[model samples]
Target: MYQNYNNNQLCLSIPLEINISSNHVAVAISHFVDSIPDKLIYEKAMTSGRPAYNPAMLLKVILFAYTRQNFSGRKIEAMAQENIPTKWLIGDPDTVPSYRTINRFRSSDQMKRLVEAMFLSFRQLLKAQGLIDDSALFIDGTKLLADANKYTFVWRKASERFEGQLDKKIAGLYQELVQNKVDLAMSDEAPKTDSKTLEKTSEQLTNEIERLDQVIATEPIIPGGSPNKRLRRKFKHDRHLIDSDYLPRKRKYESNNAIFGDRNSFLRLIRMQLLCA
Candidate 1:
């Protein structure tokens, strides 16, 4: 069918305010802030340092920013400038707080107990609404966005025994499958690089990609009627990833790392852990 993914860009425009207001995080945080006793925030209010931001509004921004897995002051400032949801939480489109200001506010003793109290307030609100009872509230890690060192995340492989040799292990597994004479290819169409993939190595990632290439030289990747549709779709995508190419620069790697962008092949890195197991 018409090769694959023929992308065409068309410009579309809409009011930015609507996008901000519709975000559930913004709405919930706004409601939560509004529900808080104003006296709690006003009690700690200071008259120093320029006209201050409304404590409730500032608290809402910090908490909402934390929910999006963003903990860095600089990142929050950047988001305030660009993220619509963040702007909505701030209650002003033009006011992006400085990183230093966000840092000071979040780290200050005045605010240290505020987040905890906010959670308690939320629990109370839930109880009042009969959504929960007086019993202990459970932590949903996703909502909490528990803190971690941005530089120190543990990749899934780090939990496995062969963490360091993860890539090589993947190569070995795919190599074994090749030796066992298994047919991993289905598409007769040429392997297409449809997504921006981070480079695992300068060379294209795995035997599956090379094998798929060899097959595509003779056939198109045909969709299979595997009983497990998800697995089938996953395999097809992994096969395409195999035939992809590595990026050329460190700049590309940084951009890719930020979003954990697609990679030329992760199937080997992923499947290798399975085989090694």
Candidate 2:
């Protein structure tokens, strides 16, 4: 028999936060997560049974695990058991979430959206506290791996630079069309020459060249007939410019814009060092 042992004994109550250091990363995680409005974490409430594990606590656990470089679900579960700071964040002595539960919550679509929102909120908080300037992000020199394709990374600055050069070239071509007296009926003060504008210009040039060809073929020049040679050469030159320059540039712009698609920046890895710091 166990000496004065009772499995159901109630111990003295103590605040979990007291056991965790004020300056510990886990404490920071707890405070940061708690700072986020509850509406973001609790999209829906359970209909029955004991209340679900607090999403804020789950977030704290996940973030604290990441700080410790414990990415694997099993490792995080074990860490939750053995790590005092992490256990304090959870605060429930009897409840240790299974690895499967932890993995499912992190991998869910809701979590994905929530993480994006959290990042935005985190950055805003940093800005308000004078910890980060909009112009600069001071991350440590630690190399962190990201789960995205390197080839698909599109830099906004590079895209803008290329687009500016393309527009300048297109504007030059438009000036040539004006100088040549080509009647495409476009204005000098028209909106910026985007991919659609370029495509329309290319099509107009191609049709004009075809019309010039038909005129040269069907209307034989009488002794004083309007000269076809000059007309044919002008239209052909414009057609060649559109084909060689405008169309290719338009395609490139379209492809790059498609890849960029509402993202002002590439997939950035948030190093735990930066967050914990």
Candidate 3:
């Protein structure tokens, strides 16, 4: 069949649903943040300065970046330039933001409270969608892992129950793979590559499982803490590290609560216990 290409196309003519599947998260968050009145966050808008990206779109892209574990502002900037999901989130492929712009907006004092507000909004959305229960306590971190299904958490007396199953599955796959390789070597037919493919698949799965096992006890990173030593210190308390670092950080956070001028609003917005890790 002959091939055809539209080199001068002006529009994709793609359905919004199919287009958004690259990152449905962007759609969900943008909708929520767009509904937020700007006056609530900024006292007055600056009209004299050069125009910037829409706050709602920027906020959506930033929030989606965090979910993917991309924390560096430079990385975020690059994502805006290169990642289709990010471009789709922004709704304009040409609107690439500079790293400096992203970093400044991210580190702004206004963003601190704005982000909390967004998180509060997100929690409500989750509750409305029946992903999170009414109770505030979050004992299961996997809920944050994006598995919106799977409701129950079973108590486990032994670690091997889960790892044993993984071990058996991996072993069975490996055995099949080895048997296939042996058979291929013995056969006079054309060389078979399925054994090697199966080996690679099993290896990839085993490596991924091992990686998850290694990450189970890792610390939960508090966002926007790299530039603020005080905030990073404060987040230690969230991780249950009540050492010398925690007390001063706690005091500092309390002192800054009023300094930020959003103590009441912040408290009202966030009710969940701070369990970073």
Candidate 4:
């Protein structure tokens, strides 16, 4: 038997407002992103003869989403649907392009260039706003793994052992043929074969031998006793390194690097810090 106790309810409530005025971050980012010039980035539509959407507005929406860490096009579309500021930035239209269109724009080479330029522009704007400190910057590095699997790596030792065995077998066969030139006579008077088939077979064997030889020669050598084991360890330890150079240098083979979003967020953060300062 069990007894239940009716013990209490605590309710917390806070007033909520639905509408709010445009804020500086949104307005500043929108204005700064709009300052990026778009010239012939999109071709004129053939059928209806007008662009499907405003390139600038799309660009602004994408950059804003990127800066806010909302990289998914689907999410951005949802935001445009529900968020008033996003809708206003995107022109508050009755329709927005599907996520596919947004993804295509993000992946395009033109879009990549535009994003880079926008980053530079944001940096300049930050400088203009006296928000950037040439000195005193943070530097860090990270590693990103390539989308490849261990199965793709060829085992060097196994390949070398196979090649060595093949070479020894071929050498032994050649030695036996030289030692017993008893090919001077056919066994039990078998019918003689045409020279063409014999020649073709010889050529094929020679080609196969040569191809195997080339593969063995050109393949990367693993230094350890077991090439496959070494390769496994190396693959396990391998990383795609990324490094940031606060004091920018022109030419240095650093790690793979990307600016988070457009550098607009960085600029805005700096501006906020300056305002607080």
Task: Tell me the TM-score of each prediction against the true structure.
Answer: 0.42, 0.44, 0.41, 0.39
Largest lDDT belongs to which candidate? Answer: 2
Angstrom error of the Cα, residue 4, model 3: value is 9.0
- Model 2 per-residue lDDT tens digits across residues 1-277: 6589886998887654538667888877777887788788888877998777777888899999998888999999998888888788888666799899899989988799889889988977787889888785557764545534444555887878887887787778788787766665666576447766666776877777777788878876577655665766776776777678777877766676776777875643334322323
Q: Please rank every candidate by TM-score, starting with the best.
A: 2, 1, 3, 4
TM-score of structure candidate 2:
0.44
Candidate 4 versus truth, CA RMSD in Å, comes to 22.6
- Which 10 residues in a row give candidate 2 its minimum summed lDDT? 268-277
Q: In candidate 2, how many Å is residue 141 off?
A: 16
TM-score of 4: 0.39
* Model 4 misplaced stretches (Cα beyond 4 Å): 1-24, 40-50, 133-277
List candidate 3 stretches off by more than 4 Å.
1-18, 35-37, 41-43, 135-277
| Shift of residue 106 alpha carbon in model 2, Å | 0.4
Please, what's the RMSD in Å of model 1?
25.4
lDDT (tens digit, per residue) of candidate 4 on 1-277: 8786655756575634333366645677687876665553454445765556766778877877777789998999887787766776776545676788888877877677876888888888888889995887654553344433323332444434554554454344334433433132334343222333233324433444455466556667656554434433332222110012111111110110122232221111111111211
The 0-to-1 C-alpha lDDT of every candidate, in the order given, reads 0.58, 0.76, 0.57, 0.53
Q: What is the lDDT of candidate 3?
A: 0.57
Indicate whether candidate 1 or candidate 2 has the larger lDDT.
2
Report the lDDT tens digits of candidate 1 across residue range 1-277.
5765635856575655635445487888888878877766665556687887777777888888889899998898998999878887786787888889888877877687777777788988888889987567554542423333323432333323332243344355355444545453425333222223222221333543465455555654457732334333444554444444222332333343444434332222111121211
